[model samples]
Target: MLPQPNRQMALAQYRLRARFYDAELAAFEPVRLRSVGCLQLQPGNTVLDVGCGTGLSLELLHKGVGPQGQIVGIEQSPEMFDLARRRVARHKWRNVTLLNAPVASATIACQADAALFHFTHDILRHPDEVRHVVGHLKPGAHVAAAGLHWGAPWDWPTNWLVWMAAMYSTTSLEGLAQPWSHLLQHLGAVQLVPSPIHGVFIVCGKVLSTGSEVVHHV
Candidate 1:
């Protein structure tokens, strides 16, 4: 398990990176598509975009959920949320709602059919946050997480890239090995797919019914 990240420090880091975040994340667009696809979104199905930065994934999500569906995006940083808000407005997506608060404390009113945790390493590391968000998910709701992780021993080059990205994006070095492990505790058995980008993975699963035995995996 990784150490918890400093929330204040993370907010500060995102404040600085918010403006350029979308451009910097362009390389991972394909991963985003596949991860979101795993949600199997349907018409009128509400979805949660956890740590949705600058709302880059909003458009794609909208395509999945359609106009009747609701998109609840919870973000912590004001600067990042600002851009995300503007993007939602620019696109005239009336169904999207942006919440500028941490997932741990955010009052998410509705139970969603699916949730996406794209590149949200800090959010994934906190069990409370994961539990809170998962609690609001409807039973059997699809959940997907994609982010950086340490590569195989022979994949030093990939690890270097993961290190550099983590340094710039995450607050703690812990869980660089398997960032999605903490989330898996709630999601049960998920399909873990490694990206060609190296050190990046996409995990998808469904929320189990209450008291369902969880299949543990590293």
Candidate 2:
């Protein structure tokens, strides 16, 4: 059986990585941009940033939504959230809201037009967490996710890279082969976009309206 994700372990992990998180993620900045681009946000739209760490994606998301749009970031680690809070404060982004809580239980006040889950493997592994985020989306709202995953069985080099990154960032490596599967359950017309880097993927889809069927395109 796959090991379940441990919240306390994740919290402890981020406590140590928070200070250096942004620097560590520098190489994946392109992936972050692609994920936000998949959202296709518009002015006055509200977007949720799931597991937003140190607000690295905030600038891109803010630019996508513009000053009129709203950005709600949900994070569980106090250390990470503090940096995110400071980032928002530094830029004086009035429309961004930071919620220091787990994604499954965070009190998301708005029905967002889109949600972005960039490199949030642990959150995507939890069905309850994915459902909770999907439940707050407006019908036909866009959803985008990007993260590391196990490569083909013979691709040991790529898999090694993924393992090194996942060990540092995620509490559980379960479901790494198809990390976005749970999130896709509540979405329709899914499209899996290939990333430039091996062992990484970017998925874009829209929320399934009542009675809508799920469709996936590679």
Cα lDDT of all candidates, in order?
A: 0.90, 0.93
What is the lDDT, from 0 to 100, of the residue 55 in candidate 1? 95
After superposition, the stretches of candidate 1 with alpha carbons farther than 4 Å from their true spots are 1-3, 211-218
Top candidate when judged by TM-score against the true structure: 2
lDDT of 1: 0.90
Q: What does candidate 2's lDDT look like per residue over 1-218, in tens digits?
A: 87978999999999999999988889898888888999999989999999998999999999999999999999999999999999999999999999999998999999999999998999999999999999999999999999999999999999998899899889899999899999777889999887877889999999999999889985
Against the true structure, candidate 2 has what lDDT?
0.93
Which parts of model 2 have CA positions greater than 4 angstroms off? Answer: none
Give one digit per residue, the lDDT tens place, for model 1 in 124-205.
Answer: 9888999999999998899999999888989889888888999899998887777877777777767886565678888898
